[model samples]
Target: MRTTIGYTAESIGYVVGAQGLVSFASQTFFGTEWGWLHNVVDLPSTAYLGIVAVGLALIVGGVKMRKTPQPQKAA
Candidate 1:
């Protein structure tokens, strides 16, 4: 159960991080925000990096949880 949750978290983090990176890059490099979600949900320029940071934190937590060994169940 814990491992499943960890994998789910990691997958979500990857998606969120990718979205943030794309949005941040487009705004910073192209001088315009680009992303379907970004267009629908407008946000301050500063918040994009924050989103990325959160995603990174999630990824780390998920990976750590997944790596840790589960305790044996004694019958």
Candidate 2:
């Protein structure tokens, strides 16, 4: 159950991280010309941090999963 939760969290993080990069690109290149797109400039940094955070989350989740014991079948 814990492992499943971790995996879900990691997946969410990955998605957020990828979006951050895209947002950054749009903001950096388009700026105000893109209207609200200018807000995306901070995306690069946001994405970078998100990636790092997600990476750590994955590592921790993986370790937890490995440590978790599997259920045994009845004899």
Candidate 3:
């Protein structure tokens, strides 16, 4: 469960980061002619902080998954 949640968080982080990049590219490179994604997928100051928090949680979850032992299967 923990590992699954960690992976999920990582996926979300990638999506968020990608959205930010797309927004930047659309507004800066593409002359603000972006798609709906930029409108819905945005990371402002506080949201960026949330992104950082998600990253930290991912790292912590990875470490915990590595340090913790796995359960054995029954015969």
Candidate 4:
């Protein structure tokens, strides 16, 4: 049960991290530091890398959980 919750949180974190990274990239591509995403989400530049790292760790945890074998159940 805890593993399942971790998987769900990890999935969400991955998506949020991806969104922030892409938004920042898009802003830079347009020759600007401030993007519309900044208006919606207020993540500081310093925290961006940490957020991404956490997201990656969460995803790895989910994958590891999936790979572990489950116990057999009796009828």
lDDT of each: 0.85, 0.55, 0.57, 0.65
> Local error of candidate 2 at 62, Å?
6.6
Ranking by TM-score: 1, 4, 3, 2
**1 against 4, candidate with superior TM-score:** 1
lDDT for each residue of candidate 2 in 1-75, tens digit (9 for 90 to 100): 766776776676556555554455555566522223234443443454564466566656656775678788799
User: All candidates' TM-scores?
Assistant: 0.86, 0.45, 0.51, 0.56
What is the per-residue lDDT of model 4 for residues 1-75, given as tens digits with 9 covering 90 to 100?
656866786687778667656655655466455434566767656565565666677777777776677787898
Error of 1 at 55 (Å): 0.8
Top lDDT: which candidate number? 1
Per-residue lDDT of model 1, residues 3-72, tens digit only: 9989989998988888888888888788887776496667766678888988898899999999999999
| Candidate 1, superposed: residue stretches over 4 Å from native | none
The list of candidate 3 runs beyond 4 A from truth reads 41-75
Candidate 4 Cα RMSD after full superposition onto the native fold (Å): 3.8
* Model 4 TM-score, all chains together: 0.56
lDDT of 3 by residue, 1-75 (tens): 766766676666666555555555666565663444545655443454454455566656666665577787899
Local lDDT at 57 for model 1: 87
RMSD of 1: 1.4
Ten-residue stretch with the least lDDT total in model 3: 43-52
Name the TM-score of candidate 3.
Answer: 0.51
Cα RMSD, each candidate: 1.4, 5.7, 4.8, 3.8
